[model samples]
Target: MTTVAILDYGMGNLRSVAKAIEHVAPGHEVFVTSDPARVAAAERVVFPGQGAMPDCMRELDARGLRPAVMQAAASKPFLGICIGQQMLFDHSAEGDVPGLGILRGEVVRFPDAAMQGADGLRLKVPHMGWNEVWQRQPHPMWDGIPDGERFYFVHSYFVAPADDDIVAAQTDYGLRFTSAVARANIFAAQFHPEKSAAAGLRLLANFIRWQP
Candidate 1:
């Protein structure tokens, strides 16, 4: 049976991510683990997170899971969620922190002035609630999900990849931003698939059967 490890670096909603994966892949072994060995052993690795970039980066290293995470991202089907997605980039505007650098990019906060609708109404910073995610490219993770499907989001910052070719999806709050990225075996989303209801669950299910 396939084994999936959810990297528990003390920042993300580990249980929720695990439960979602479990719900989709009932026969697979899903572990919420801090053990580097287990992470390296798993056939699939999930990196999920929330909170400040600095703290997330610190906690990941404090637990000595950085190398394992990088290794998993390199050779396995890796998934990152929310802060998990931001942490994949080179740096973050939040706390001026550097990320895992697994992907070449920077996490940037949504500008305050740009936080307005075309109608002239102000939008919130966090960009909370459901918003349409436009599929930028064809990907396995987008299987069975509509192109303009809405996903749950609760983040102030979004990734700006150095290479646009890596971007899998985009969403607009006040302005368009990279909401999801995919390259090789790595797929990460700025939105929470766990909390996104039907479409979200579909995404998790897709990840279970994804070969890349």
Candidate 2:
């Protein structure tokens, strides 16, 4: 039986994620765990985080999950969501805190000017609600999903990976931001699949059945 561990770093909705995964993949053992050893032992890891970057970074280290999370990303099928996705990068504008550096990129806040639409309408800083995520490249996570699907998003900052090839999907608020990233056994998103209805569920389902 496949074991999926949702990293419990004292952040985000871990239970909701576990339930979502359960709905899609019934046979898998899905559980929320803060234990680093359990994380390392799991067949798959889902890193879901919320709150500020600095606090999240501190908690991850405090819980002794930094190394295990990085190792999992490198060795097995890994999925990162929302703040979880941002922390995979090198740095974040939020408190100017550094990230795991697993991926070569930086997290930056949406510039105030970039918040203005072409019609002079201003969008909110935290880009909440559903927005269309445009596919930047072909990816396994996007297998059954369409090119432009609406997903739930609630974030002020976004990742800017040094390599554009790592970006799997892009979304436009006032500007285009890297919304989803994928490379090998890793796939991450800036939206909440648990709150995203069918499209979100599809991605989770795909991840559950993903071999790498």
Candidate 3:
């Protein structure tokens, strides 16, 4: 009976995320909404994004969903996915775009050139495919999820939180980066749990069962 609103900002894979959530929590109501009012009325909010950070921010601002999102995150359960997670930060180096500034930090590109191997082959940007997430702290949102589980990720930027204590999980591309973060009622993941198969479903289930 939990009412979950998946914010449709015109830049994310909204259907897939909603479908996945429905699969995980069958009877829960899932609504894909661009309206700030509906988003505010939901029991939980799921923010999902896949495109550039700046574009997503502009669209959210254009639609007047920014304040609603922040308000929902203030006391309700907020789950951010992929770019949605990055947007929670202060800024992103991707497009010189300012983010929601919810979390105090910047999203930076992978240190690809700086992490060259002995053969001088630089690590590629836009890390795509399945990557393992290392849990840093116990969270109700991560309950029943195991360590070393691979999740789907496709992004060039990663979150670097100013407060290390808020980091709930870490993942390595060229180096270790904050893959998941949790602060009070806000929880976010850099990877796409929708595309991560069973392990991903467990995460969605946990989010559904989580009490704030």
Q: Which digits, one per residue and each the tens of the lDDT, describe model 2 over residues 16-100?
A: 8988999999878998999999999999999999999999999999989999998999999999999999999999999999999
- Model 1 segments more than 4 A misplaced: none
What TM-score does prediction 3 earn? Answer: 0.95
Error of 2 at 88 (Å): 0.6
Q: TM-score rank, highest first?
A: 1, 2, 3
For 9-103, candidate 1 gives per-residue lDDT tens digits of: 99999888888889989988999999999999999999999999999999999999999999999999999999999999999999999999999
Worst 10 residues of 2 by lDDT: 110-119
Best by lDDT: 1
Against the reference, the lDDT scores of all candidates come to 0.93, 0.93, 0.90
Tens digit per residue, CA lDDT, model 3, 1-212: 99999999899999999999999888889989999999989999999998888899999999899999899889799999999999999989989999988899999988657765346767677788998999999888777778878999998889999999999999877688999999999999999999999999999999988886
Clashes of each: 0, 0, 0
Q: What TM-score number comes out for model 2?
A: 0.97
Q: Candidate 3: list runs displaced more than 4 Å.
A: 114-122
